[model samples]
Target: MEADLPHLVAFMLGTGVRIGEALAVHWHEVDLEAGTVEITHTIARVRGEGLIRKVTKSRAGERLLHLPNWALAVLRARHAAGILNDPVFADTRGGYRDPSNTRRALRTALSPVGNTARRDLGLSLRTLRRETGMTRKQVANHLNWPQNRVELVETGRIKVDHELVRTLVATYNVDLEQFHGLLAQIHDAVQPAESDKLAWIRSHALRKTTATALDQAGHTARQIADQLGQAKVSITQDIYMGRQSANPAAAQALEHAFDDPDLL
Candidate 1:
């Protein structure tokens, strides 16, 4: 009963439900009959305070997200358990879900996919965000939420959109349109990389040291990750190591990294 975190997290990410929104979801918020989820609130806990239910982060936070077929199936499986009206994600006490526990669960679930460590997890999350590239404010705006609250829903940060689905199809060359409205029927897939990961390996020393050189060259974490075949969290670790010296083309690389979508 407590072991489905990975699938659940992947479903939430696919749905763009933000961590807080995901935790706050209730059976009532999920309209199984309509195949939608109404995001109405978020869970938060500030320093010195225990967890509390709060209005969603922004006006954009309150939204009606049409669940993808995969999301719908996951929801259906949960609903079939007959716990309607209960918090969709309850805690140890079967009360409101704890955000920390939920995050831990998500990390735990992502373990087999190389996200077990904190650095690796951060890298994975940043990779997701960069791939999406929608800002926290943009996500909030779409969700009808306050800009400030956008950060809390980091996992489910962006609102689901057709663009994402289209990207999935186009980038992966999957004939998803043939499936019509049955999005859940499609198998999970990943897009192919355009560049050679080996190129970065040949250009840099250790994968761990590449980020520092790039950072000293004034590259952003995103840029370094994109160019070095590493993740932003890994780049941050290199920067933290304090042994990085500026490399040639660091500034130029940073400036132009985003110009080429193919590089990513």
Candidate 2:
């Protein structure tokens, strides 16, 4: 991503706040000297209201976050360059950035060829959901999905088809071919742009990275939860925390199971 998006990504990476929350951040909410930013609002597009600055998604999403030095440097540079009272990451016109469009730009930057990778597909679906102003949890509850399944689908780990998209969008039986045609058009429209090496990175990935870093640094699950504005530590542990890649100890335990003398 170009221009201010890199700074925005860095801010999100440091703070672990949701994309909407990051978009809604105003200069007034930031305490540069204190190295903290209050999370009070989030930007979302309402059907008739256009872009509205609303309260945080959850009460716990309103916690204050301490900025790392690098994030603070980003804020300082922005503060020096930007007008006061505007959003910390305002659009070119100095208004809130639409999450849908931002996500599309991100996808295009990552895969400028418009190949429509599984991650892009997930992001496209995510854009659709954001357009409808529905949270992942709400969608999961509506579809009777397991708690983490929505997140997994949107992360592109699970294969998705247009049928699933139609179902999730809550549309009546219609022409699936037409939907495919429209999706193709959307893919064609994403213009490629310059991006950093973390082209595959999305905001949620940054949050998970931050959480895993905190865990490695000896922070408790609750501490990470607080930093991430998650109400439940269990959710933090289950969703944000990354699993160890090489479980050598577990492997040894498994091998030991075969060492039992008594054969059943």
What's the TM for model 2? 0.56
Q: Candidate 2, residues 140-235: lDDT per residue as tens digits? A: 988898665567556654445555666776622334456675477334433342322446677677778777766666666666676777766676
Question: Candidate 1's residue-wise lDDT over 1-264, tens digit each?
Answer: 474453455345334455666777888778777666777777888778778778775544565655445556667876787545456766656677676666644443332231123223233333544577666566557656655433422333222234444443343234546645324312121222222122232111233443454567576664444333222346556556432222234434333322333321
* Model 2 Cα RMSD, 1 decimal: 15.1
Per-candidate RMSD, Å:
23.3, 15.1
What lDDT is reached at residue 20 by model 1?
68
All candidates' lDDT scores?
0.49, 0.66
lDDT of model 2 at position 232: 69
List, in order, the clash count of every candidate structure.
16, 0
lDDT of 1 at 115: 16
lDDT of 1 at 255: 34
